[model samples]
Target: MSLPFSPQSSLHQRLRVGLGTMLVPLIMLAGGALISFEGAVGSFEQQDSISRQALFPLAEVEGEILELTSVATHAQPTNTMTLQNYRRKQLVIKSQLALLSDYFQGQPTKFNSVQEIRRQWLEIARLCEQIFEATEPEQLANAKVQLSQRLQGILKNTQELNYRLIAFQNEANFDKARAVREKVRYLVAFISLLALALALLFAFYLSRSITDPLQTLAKGVEKLGQGELHHRITLETQDEFNHLAETFNLMANQLEQSQQDLYRLATLDGLTEVYNRREFNRWLLVEIERSQRGEHPVSLIMVDIDHFKRLNDTYGHQAGDLALCEVAQLLQREVRPGDIVCRYGGEEFGVILPKATSADSWVIAERIRLAIAEKSVVLPSQQHIDMTASLGVATYPDHADCKERLVKQADQALYTAKYQGRNRVHSAEVNECNHQINKLQRMLVKQGT
Candidate 1:
């Protein structure tokens, strides 16, 4: 006769069963340990609080009583001020006794002691009052003597009570300490036993289930470290380690994809999806060096949207963004394949033309300006808004030698275009002197040049 194979006999199931069986006991052990420690600590703290609340005030009461006794014995025909001082000390003693009573409310034993002390304190207070009321010199002297003797007796009793309280507190503290020590000893033994049992269970389970999977995983990790990203761990147990291996493979795939995505994001603008300012600068520097070495030309065109702020204020930012995107698309459509267009900044765009002369760049900029002027952006409100762009063209080694100077010249040209009129293209070569001379020549040429 043969029995059927159970899934519980599998390695994964055995691991789960073993961990589940141990987990509850381990948790119970930890919880019990924490509770025991907290109980011990709480007991110590409660005892200390009682000492501070009751015993400390009792000591203060004894001190105040002694001060009152000194005043009664030393004052010659005690004055009203001396009596007032004595009464004040008496009241302080009474208040402290009342507080002590409150502190020992639930405990009959401590409360009884507090009552006894209070009774003694009241007798001393009465003696003090009698000393204060005596008016005649002889009567005052006698009252003073009597109050001193009475205070001595009460002080003796109080010292004895204080000693007893100290002894009791010390004994209670010793008992608590012994109990805590025993608890710690028992807990240590229990923890040692529990740990030993758990260790044996872990050793058995690790030997049976984990060692081979860990070795395989280590090898797979080594392969991954060696750049073999396609390598994968194989495990037949279908346990957590198998799941972890699958996650590792997924992570590798995601890491590869993320690298490509990061590269694209770094090089391209988020909104316009064109070369960003950073990429444009990088390309411009490379193009400048190439032009310097080859003795060829590189051109830069700076374009600004005309009345963009007014457009934003009139139709809102959403409409303004649509206009900018439309302008970017027009620029992209007008430029050659080798030319790079970038959203240089808000309401501004830059075009980098490699190996293109100033004349070539001016023609391209004019075409871009005309295309942007013709295009109309449709808003979410179904309203069509026409927009225009001002463009400035400057070429490397022709307008300026370096990248920075060339960009500056182009920017100046763009400023001139905006100053002259909107929707126009201007070249950097047209300086103020050249412009004046050209104006005179144009006037003469109006007859025909």
Candidate 2:
């Protein structure tokens, strides 16, 4: 029998545990990744945008300077319209640079670079104003020469800063993004593999828990089906499968008991509680076949209750039944363990001895006769009557070879014993069979009976 299941031992509980074990790590991994990306990666995204934005202002300043230099170089030397355009463009460029300077206040390096560019811009504007005022070719050429020299230093500084900002964005965003993706891959792979392994482990557990018990039960049922009435099952799982195993074993026990009951009903004599006539004939055949091998001879003693018809007429059928039961009990008690006693018919019995000779048969038959004569049966009216039986002994390979001949010879000897005196042992192997009766009587008396 199995113990009852605790909550933890329940099937549903086990399933829940398996699922939780498989999913918990993945869940934690997902949650951790989400939190890390939200805080750290969000910060990186904002920094990446700010770095790209920083370049926009610098690029605008460079474009404005280039446009002003172009207008100055292409202008007619004596044209007032060109000078007006240069003055308006110069004011706009200075205003834009001031905003760019404020944007770089957090970095001293970039702020210093913007301050240098501002100084250079003021120098370039003064030379351009000189070129616009000059009418002589020598004066114009001298002012343009100074403007070109200042533009070279400021343009180089701006382009170099722009290259540095591009390199910073690549380092800050692309490299970190690759590292984050690799970390995610490792986490996902680890969680997926762990969950798969756990799933496989639990699958094996469930299979054994489920299929092992089922196989045991199936084997038990098969044995029972094959008429093995003593087969049983054992299981120790603290779950419904164990309970089912216990139930199946219980059912097998009941089925075995029922089969025994059926066998008793079919093969036992109801009145005498001995084997019935059908079993007697079947066993006789079996014994005869064994004796045919010639190594060990078998014997049979056919017994009939003397004066049974007269007893039934005198008392009642119940008295006759009691006498039969008493005689059967006495025969069973006197016989050896290997001997078989059967109610051959109404008031008649057969004893099969597997390895007994004719002499042994005669002795056992006489003992049975003496035991029957001493036994007393009480009628329903409370009257006691002494009973006696006539037995005929026959041995295989001497009196008969087959079951039919053995039983026929024993029956003939029985008829002869009854005809002679009705309470004597007769043997088919002997002509008189009178010598052993008195000898067995003396032997029984000397046994402290």
Candidate 3:
């Protein structure tokens, strides 16, 4: 039976294949989105932690300075204790300023957050320097007032700056996180729809492919059995099922060619390229049958190169092979299309021309003889040798009935041609050739001698 639908509908198959390709990438995109979301959240937390850490060093220095000022006002302080307290406050402020500078160094833009922090840190460092240079109690008191005022100013400025920076960074993080979440949501929905669509397309496409080629193959096989050898399967897809269809088509083609080759090889003579003896026998029998039915004339010709043995001995065996090939060409060229030529054996050639009288066969046989006489076989060494052949012809349904008897009569005529003179045509009677075969042959013989 024929296929319900053609196999060349590739759109559905392509959609199925495309779906398989997209599946893995969709999974990877989803996983990558999840990782990005986690990284954004982690970054927000770290930023908050770092901003808080930036404040700690300043706060610690201010607390120590306040303690030292209170002790100078209320407690009985030894000189060494006062000086020691003063030294400790100076060292702490310097250390805090160094930490603040380190924090500002890593920021993208050192404009607001970094510049304000640095300015405040510089004022604190100047105050600590003034305290270190103080010589009297009143001088120390004045230095403490300057240090306290500078510290309070630094704290206020840094606090406001830090607050604004942290707020801006958090807003950016929130926006980015929201964008990533929306992308994930959209991607998930799209993938769900895509997966469903892909599954449906794949199932339909695969099911159709499975049945269509089998149906085509079945129809093609039936046609092949009936000897309609031109039947072929057409497949459009590059997938496995299509590959199988192509293979089936190729097998059918080879099978058809194999049958033709076997028929030819069985009927053809391998060396001379004429019909083999079996084919010659069959053709002669058919001609005889036709003659018996319609009373049509048929003729047979048997040809052999004269002194074939002496020729092969004088020239080499390879030259004898060339002689056969050249003779086959001459036969095909000289005989009519209806004529059948066969290589009878080593140095013998045969011909069957239907509807030809003995007279017509004689003319063709003489033509072949003259054609061979006119041409010489040339070798690669600039050596050329002339050759000649004798022909015998017999009329069919007149002289004989069976194919074997027709051939025998032709052979007898050929023997007569050889006996009377080696290079001439003899059919029913000897016919004198006006050409000189001996002139060329005599030259060749001299060269050989």
Strongest candidate by TM-score: 2
Q: 2 or 3, which is superior by lDDT?
A: 2
Please state the error at residue 448 of candidate 1 in Å. Answer: 50
Order of the predicted models by TM-score, top scorer first:
2, 3, 1
Query: Model 2, 181: alpha-carbon shift in Å?
Result: 1.5
TM-score of every model?
Answer: 0.44, 0.67, 0.49
**Of models 2 and 3, which has the larger TM-score?**
2
Tens digits of per-residue lDDT for model 2, 227-288 = 88798888766677677778888998898889889999899998888999999999988887
lDDT of each: 0.80, 0.81, 0.72
Predicted candidate 3 versus true structure: per-residue lDDT over 7-120, tens digit per residue: 544545555564565575567567666766786677667766766666576566556645655644432224466557666776786777577667767665534555665576
For model 1, the run of ten residues with the poorest summed lDDT: 1-10
Q: For candidate 3, what is the TM-score?
A: 0.49
Higher-TM-score candidate among 1 and 3? Answer: 3
Considering lDDT, where higher is better, how would the candidates rank from best to worst? 2, 1, 3
Off by over 4 Å in 1: 1-246, 430-449
- Among the numbered candidates, top lDDT falls to 2
Residue-by-residue lDDT tens digits, candidate 1, 1-449: 11111212445555665666567567767777787889889999998887777678888988998888778776543487787787688778889889878988898877887788788777766666666676777887777777777778777867876887789889999999998989877886787688778767765764656666778888888987887766776676455677877888787677667766786799988778888899989999999999867868899999999999999999999998888888888888899998999988999999999999988998999889888888999999899998899999998776775678888999999999999987899999745565566446645855685
Clashes of each: 0, 0, 0
| Candidate 3 Cα deviation (angstroms), residue 92 | 78
What TM-score does prediction 2 earn? 0.67
